[model samples]
Every structure is written in C-alpha cells, then in structure tokens.
Target: MEIIQTCDEMAMACRVAARPLGLVPTMGALHAGHLSLTTQARCDNAILAVSIFVNPTQFGASEDFSSYPRSMERDLALLEEQGADLVFAPPPEEVYPAGFDTWIEPGAVAEGQEGEVRPGHFRGVATVVAKLFTIVRPDRAYFGQKDGQQVAVIRRMARDLNLGVDVVTMPTVREPDGLALSSRNAYLKPHERQAAPVIYRALCAAEQLWRSGEQDAGALRSAALAVLRSELLVESVDYVRVVDAETMVGVDAIGEQAAMVAVAARVGGVRLIDNVVLV
Candidate 1:
C-alpha cells in the first residue's frame, strides 16, 4: 500500500485512481472495530484508503495527544493485511503546515456528551475530518458507531457542507465483557481494564430498562448510573444521557426512532466512552 504524508500528494494519488475511492480516517491504533470499518469500505468501494494521523487539533490542553498511541508499523501491517489500497500517515506539520487558521464547526450537535467533556474536541475533529474529506475526496467514508457523537457530527457536517460523500457508520465492536474497542484502551492499567467494562454494562442496563417499558429518560439515566457506580475504578461519571440519534437534543422519553444511551468515565486516568442504541 502506498503511504503518502502530504495533503497535496494524497490528493493527487486519489485524483489518479480509476475506481470509486473509500476513506477510513483513524487516529491509528488499529483494532477489530477499525478493521470492520475498512472491511465495509473495501466491500462497498473499488479502492480503500486509510488515513492514520493522530490529529493534534482534536485534543484538548490536558488531553493525551502527546502520548497517544503510535504504531505505524503495526497499523500499516493491519491495513495492508485488510487490502487497503493506500495509507495516508501525515505528521501534524504536514497537515497543518505553519500558521494554519482553518477550522470546521458542527454547531450545537457538538455541545453535549463527548463535546461537553472535551471542549473544542469536536471542533478539532470536524476541522481535521473536513480537511481529510477534501483531500481524499472519497465516494464513501467509514466510521465506527463507537463514536456516536462523532458519527452524528460528521453526518451533520457532510449534509450542512454538501460534501457529497456517503458516510457509513458501523456498529461498535466490543470484547466479550462489553468494553468498546478504543485506541485509548491501551492506557488502562490491569485492574482498571477490568473495571472498564462497567461503562458498557451501564449502557446495557439502560438498554434493558428501555426494553422493559421504562421509557422515562430520567429513570433510564438513573438506572445506568447505578450500574456504572459498581466499578470502583471509575473516578467520575462524566455523563449518562439519552438523546435523539440525529439531533442529539435530550428527550424526555424514548420514541420509535433511535436514541443514544451514552456514558463517560475516567478509569485509571484513561477516559472511556460507550453507548447502546435504544431501538
């Protein structure tokens, strides 16, 4: 697979492709969830491109961007094994250059959930993703539902900006115990790793409550919080919210359409987020 580092070169490479291109944008700690996105893109498009840049702009002042996982060799191996046509692994310098002043704003859809915890986080995400979308110009782009708010933000961005790319969101991949796969999972200590499953467990509890005719949003959030508190490793409950999957505005009751039951907590200094959809 060709590994291009500059935005110009990456754009040129895509410009010459004869087939419909697919792009899987990631921060590069390749896991089964990431591979699933690439697999889906490969199946749907004639060519697949994976971008493995850990975007610095998306990280907050005290965030882990400086120490975020970086395994270019392993990531490349995984993408190559999955038949990725190209891998764009750009450094911050290459993508940002000097004095870069552009940013993409997703407006209010980014004001809650993950957005609330990591201020300006989604702004950075929206900006970098907009840049990647411009460079790759893919017919289809893939994202994991592991980032529900991200999916919602990108969906809104694409529609608002008329980017004309098909954004496909795959289900979150999890371990047998239910923790969603994440690049940050590498930061969890042994005991913290064990306690991390409560995030998913909490979401599951909320899902069960919704299924058992407990449609009250406040009751659902309370039930989920109770389950999450079981994990002593969790430093704090960042949030447990139910919202319209599209608008992201909190709802008083669950409806026929989908809603996000999301949670966030710090486990041994590593923050984890997970969600279950209420159908």
Candidate 2:
C-alpha cells in the first residue's frame, strides 16, 4: 500500500490514477470493522483510498487525541489485504498546515450525543471530511454505523454542499460479547473490558422494550438508562436519545418508522457509545 503524508502528493497521485475512487476515512488502529469498510469499498468502487489520520480538531481539550491508538504499519497491511488501492496516512500538520481557518458547521445535528460531549467535534469532522472529499474526489465513501451521529452529520454536509458522493452506512461490527469495535476499545483495562459490553446490552434492552410494543421514547430511554445503571462501572450517562435517524431530532413516538436509540457513557476513563434501532 502506498502511504503518502502530504496533500499535494496525495492529490497528484489520485489524479494520476485517473480512476473512479471510494474512500474509507479512519483514525487508524485497524480492526475487523475497518477491514469490512475497506473490503466493501473495494467491491463497490473501481479504486479504494483508505485514509488513516488521527484528527486532533475533533477532540475536546480533555479528550484522548494525543493518546488515541496509531499503528500505520498494521493499518496499511489490513487495507492491502482488503484490496485497497492506496493508503493515505497524512500527518496532522500536513493536513492542517499553518493558519488553516475554515470549518464546516453541521448545525443542530452536531449538538447532541457525541457533539454535546465534545464541542466543535462535528465541525472538525465535517471540515476534515470535506478536505478528504476534495482531495480524493471519491464517487462513494464508507462509514460505520458505530458513529451514527457522525454518519448523520456527514450525510447532511454532503447534501448541503452538493458534494455528489454516495455516503454508505455499514453495520456496526462487534466483539463476541457485544462491545462495538472501536480504536478506543484498547484503552479498557481487564475488568473495565467486562463492563464495556454494557453499552450494547443497554441498547439491546431498549430494543427489547421497543419490540414488546413500547414505543414511547421517554420510557424507552428510561429503561435503557436503568440497564446501564445496573453496571457499577458506568460513571455517568451522557445521553439516552431516541431521535430520527436522518434528522437527529427527537421523536415523541417511534411509530412505524424506526428511530435510533443511542447512548454514551463513561466506563472508567474510556467513553463508549452504542445504539440500536427502535422499531
């Protein structure tokens, strides 16, 4: 896999390829989830460009940007195995440069869940994704449902800007015990690892409640919060929202159209998020 760090070189290389492209943007500690996105992109597009940049602007002041996992050697191997045509592992400085000023505002969609916790997070995400889209000019892009809020924000940005790229949302990949596969999962200690699965469990509980003819959003959220509280390691609940998947607006009742029941919590030092469809 060819790894290029500079925007000029990367853009020139993409131009030289002169083929339809697909992109899978990531913050690099490669996992099965990431591999799935890469493989799907390869199957769907003429060429695949996998970007592994750990974006700092997305994180809040106290967040784990500096300590987030990074293993480019392994990341490239995984992408190559998944048939990615190119790997762009740009340095933060290379992407941001000096005196970079503009940002993409996802508006109200960026104000809840992940955004509420990390202000300017979606702006950073939107700006970086817009930059990547400009550089790669991919016909399609892949994102995991694990970051449901992010997918919503990116789709909104694409629509608002008329970027003309298909945004595909893939299912969330999970471990056998049901913890969502994430780069940050590495931070969990031995005991906290066991507690980590609670995020998914709580989501599952909400699903069960929904399936059993309970459609009230507030009640469903309460039930999920109860499940999370069952586990002592859950320090705090950031949000337990039942929102329209496309608009990210809270609904009073789920109805025939399903809504996303999402949550974020502090498990020791790690912040884990998980969601399920309430149908």
Clashes of each: 0, 0
> What does candidate 2 score on TM?
0.97
What is the TM-score (0 to 1) of candidate 1?
0.98
lDDT (0-100) at residue 156 of candidate 1?
Answer: 96
lDDT of 1 at 8: 92
Write one digit per residue (lDDT tens) for candidate 2, span 87-123.
8888889889899998888888888888888889999
TM-score of each: 0.98, 0.97
- Computed on alpha carbons, the lDDT of every model, listed in order, comes to 0.90, 0.89
Instruction: Rate residue 60 of model 1 by lDDT.
Output: 88
CA lDDT for candidate 1: 0.90
Inter-residue clash pairs, candidate 1: none
Off by over 4 Å in 1: none
